[model samples]
Target chain A: MSDVTAGALESYLTGRLAADVSVSDLHEHVEGWSRDTVSFTARWNEEGEQRERRLVVRAESDAQIEGDSAAEGNDVETEFRTMAAAEDTSVPVPETYWYEGDRSVLGGRFFVVGHLPGDAPVVWDREQRQDLYRAWDEREANEGDGKADGRAKGGSENDGGSLPSQFVDAAAGIHTLDAEDVSALADCPPDAVVERELDRWVGRYRASTVRPEPAVEECIRWFRSNPPEIPETTLVHGDFRIGNILVNEGELTGVLDWELARIGDPLYDLGYASTYYFAGKLIEPIERPELACSLLDREWFYDEYERRSGRVVDRERVRYWRAFSAFVMMTIGLAGVHRFRTGETDDVRAAWFQYIVPGLIEDMLAIVREDRL
Target chain B: MPYLEPAAVLRRFSRFALEEIRPAIDGEERFVRGQVGSMASTLRFLAGELDASERAVTTQENALHEALDGVEHTLDDHDAAATAVREALADARDTLDGTDDEAGSRIRGTRERETTLLEACDDVLARVEANLDDETARAVRRPLYDFLDARLDAQLRTLGRRNESGDGSP
Candidate 1:
């Protein structure tokens, strides 16, 4: 809730588009707690040519940037730069249009990106998945590339089938990005990213309340005791999942939400995606067969990634990341917990997360126990 | 002393918030209606647990003692091993629950300890449970399960998919 009005947004876009920018439509999406997404359509003229463009402006809200007190460098500028760096890569990122680096203009800095066309529906919907699988199956039989164009009537297929393989391939694509490509990426302390995130979350959660969670404390102790081997460092999409990426014409169109994108161990993304998948299964009680789950299990996922990337996968490292994913999710809950407890945000999602911190710790411990035993 | 219990009044308001007043609320906060519904359920749970949590903690403590006692019978006849386990549990629990001024303190200072009193107790209990045999472990964990199971259920109700009602059938 900055006092930056719709007129300010129009002025900014008008300068960027270099035309008479009149915002035809403008509305902020209420879902994202981290970044407020304002979707708008601008009608502008450039050199006697009139062009209407649909775009999205992502503005940072108050959340600890891995424990940053104020949203300083972790604003829309960072995402704008990251997207610009990732443009030439195989990764399907949105085209970054303009970044308002100075916060004074918009009251808080914001970035605009051209909205890519893709139907990014619920990823875990069995009916949607079944359709995607059937489309791929059809594509394999008829098309030369054997890649589905994301068009098929869902619900007939028994499993996700080849869709899982494609998803893995797309994930590995991010991992395969050369460090030289993302040259502007900051250098992290060697093998300290996990510990950094752990401390960051701990700081946030501790700040939230006088009450403490023993499970998380124990998990942190365990994490400190048994540090995993650092696999090759690459551009890790801090949040990677079916929901984060757009699926269009039966292929991954674009990866969305660059807010959490960073350069780190590729396994970070794998762990995050896997934990998210595991959490969904726990909550939704989807009736996918046990064998189907096994097919898309962590090991299978690693193997698929290894085969695609031509890099040898470490069993221990993958296991650690899988559990670490849960730990990260648990830590992330602390931010929401802090917001809820402080009554700064009236988000029920925040309140719900505050209530579920214990359960999150429980889930993390369960994953760690499974990994260990 | 009153016509209706305080919790009953809370439950009435909570139910009203979920079923009646929530549908009328719209926009961003409208999405939080389901969570508000969850909060209502949690309030009811807290009210129910208020009188019983002390007993639950005592039962868990006794369960831990019983688990150690079982280990002695399973291994040795002497009370040395059983006494040691009992002392260990007490030491962990006291360190967790007691302050610097209190007796048998395991903590250096009050603020030095990272986890809360209950968290410390849970850590000790978890460690104790992890060491025991299957039967002893189940015996030790049953009380904790009994205690937190209801709480977990209440919290879990909040985690359900928003905008979804009834059976999520295909």
Candidate 2:
């Protein structure tokens, strides 16, 4: 919003859409913490008729959480290519129209994509949405009470209910995308995937360290000593979580936030998906439990993943990567704290980063101990 | 000099002579050595204090659990007390928004104190789980330990931020 005027965005859209396209009602979505996300309605004169369209603009911000620079440079371009490649494939990504990596376009890189029809329930704010529990219960009942194959029939459960099945199905679709078809990222060698990713992140960590942590040093040593053996190479939706995915009426309409997409071990996605409980939520079907359940319950999603991908997932390897994912998340949280403390960034989200890092560390330690012992 | 205790006089003389007198007369190498020695000693003192406090807390927590073992139904009460303490800590944390420098410092102190308390709770719970024959005692301890573990984690995150801030430095 700093220098990204509506006129610039409209012009950019005009170039992508029809010549008579006119954009109206540009507003920001405040719920998203990652990108400078803005949802706007576009009205255009097309074929002797006025057509209305909804579009979302995802632009990079000066202030960002850690591990986002991976999305910078040609990374966004790679994402665009990946999305385009997955168009005919099973993955349900939004159809990207225009992407501008140049800084001059809107003071930072951004992409415009087709706005899919869906509504993401206010999952973050659990209080107002007491109806979610009822919705979840109804879906479970319908699935059990001779309704249909709820998993196959995507998003038919109406009444604006919870979309847990949609979420799982969309994830399975992504996991099953033909790895051989993604030729654009063929240069990414499978063997060096771990090393490349670790080096890139470690370099970022080193640069961002205002004060060194002995624990980080120890963690690095441990990571190097006990690198998990890669079983299979697949495209990792680097930030595969409930928040990044969008669902409508019990069906996944679009898989958003491909900024963190990369070619790596598929378990990274599985581990990340399972760790959503740490963000404070119950398992998929049971939207509201009387008490919090173990994140391990979400392993059914992994079983579903294995079923779809036809790969026997090594549970021990998945456990190892889960700990690694937690460590990566902790590093990002630490980076946010570093930036905020150094006055490099002035954002309130930075403070929450401090609140979450320690919990992540403890969780990571717990995972490590559980795996080893 | 007359008013000063012997220990205070020796400490004052050592600090003054090492920091001021030795630096004035000695070359850069000697000054560097003196500064390094001072820092090392300061670190050693802090490390010693932390170690002693940790040991004392562990001992007291162990004794408390040992005493509670004989008392029937006391473990449940103790477990509930620990939960209440954690809830109080959480409430305190929720209110802290780092409004001012003093508030921020207080929040940090509270976080560290809560960490210590939660760790103690975890140690006690772990011991109870090991010693108690009753399944209820073990069941009650599980949630308490889990909550305390999560709480300790949250506090450690806050501590990580504080450490990154270089708060006490001039």
* Best-fitting candidate, scored by TM-score: 1
Query: Where does the lowest 10-residue lDDT sum fall in candidate 2 chain A?
Result: A288-297
Please give, for residues B1-170, the per-residue lDDT of candidate 1 as tens digits: 88977656776776787777777777557335656766775565555444344444444444444443443354343322434345555665465344433452344432244233445445544564445454454444444433333333333443442222112211
For the second chain, the TM-scores of the candidates in order are: 0.44, 0.27
Give one digit per residue, the lDDT tens place, for model 1 in A37-64.
7777888787888888888888766443
Which segments of model 2 are wrong by more than 4 Å? A63-74, A121-124, A128-143, A146-162, A178-180, A183-187, A210-219, A276-296, A371-373, B1-170
Local error of candidate 1 at residue B140 (angstroms): 12
Q: Which stretches of candidate 1 lie over 4 Å from their true place?
A: A3-5, A62-73, A119-163, A202-205, A248-251, A276-299, A370-373, B1-3, B6-15, B25-88, B92-119, B122-170
True contacts kept of each: 0.20, 0.08
Query: Clashes in each model (backbone N, CA, C under 3 Å)?
Result: 5, 4
**CAPRI docking class of candidate 2:** incorrect
